[model samples]
Target: MAISFNQAFAGHDKMLEFRSERASVLANNIANADTPNYKARDISFDSMFNNEQSKLRLASDNDRHIQGNSTMGESSGLLYRNPSQPSLDGNTVDMQREQAEYAQNSMQFDTSFMFLDRKISGLKKALTGN
Candidate 1:
């Protein structure tokens, strides 16, 4: 009795998770903008998603292929600090850039959530024959 959503939904799930994490990081950067010597950190989802090792799934020898943990493990994207600008107080956070990035990430997060909601709604309708 295996019940699962379409494979397309998997991508959306991953994207939503990534975007949510990115938003948190961006928010953190913005919150610590005034903190002296505080370095801004960012994640590279493109590189993380592109990694082949992260996309790998366990293959069972028999027909019963039980899904296991992702090969990517608990590792997130690579954290990097911006090198373009440096504050006089040794802080690396650029408020303008961080605000823009945060706004963009928020929009992306909302979009992903909306898409997932719509998908679930569609499934509900289908199951209810409505």
Candidate 2:
């Protein structure tokens, strides 16, 4: 019997991709901190989840299997962050806030990596019967 790995991985794969893309966006914001009129951009996971919820599901091929809902290649929302205080040069990137966000994003990326690692390990254990 053929087992689709997609059935086992679930949404975590997508979540990890989203997190990675978000890291780049956050990094871009930090890199352009000094550029005038450069607006900081961020991704919203909640919005991405909500958008995924409306996707159409396909029928299962057999009675023993469930339909897979894994959709790949999602581009982030990339919305501009509104600055709490406007800078004299119109740059929207806040150094302190950007730093905090970068740190948080890094933590989240590590978390997602750990979760994926644990999941793969569990799958390995199951297949190996160890």
**Each candidate structure's count of clashing pairs:** 0, 0
Off by over 4 Å in 2: 50-76
Residue-level lDDT tens digits of model 2 in 90-127: 99999899899889988988888888888899999988
- Ten consecutive residues with minimal summed lDDT in candidate 1? 68-77
Worst 10 residues of 2 by lDDT: 68-77
Whole-model lDDT values for every prediction: 0.79, 0.81
- Report the number of the highest-TM-score candidate: 2
Residue range 85-118, candidate 1, lDDT tens digits = 8879989998899999989888888998889888
lDDT of 2 at 114: 85
Q: In model 1, what are the clashing residue pairs, if there are any?
A: none
User: Candidate 1, which segments miss by more than 4 Å at Cα?
Assistant: 6-8, 50-52, 55-75
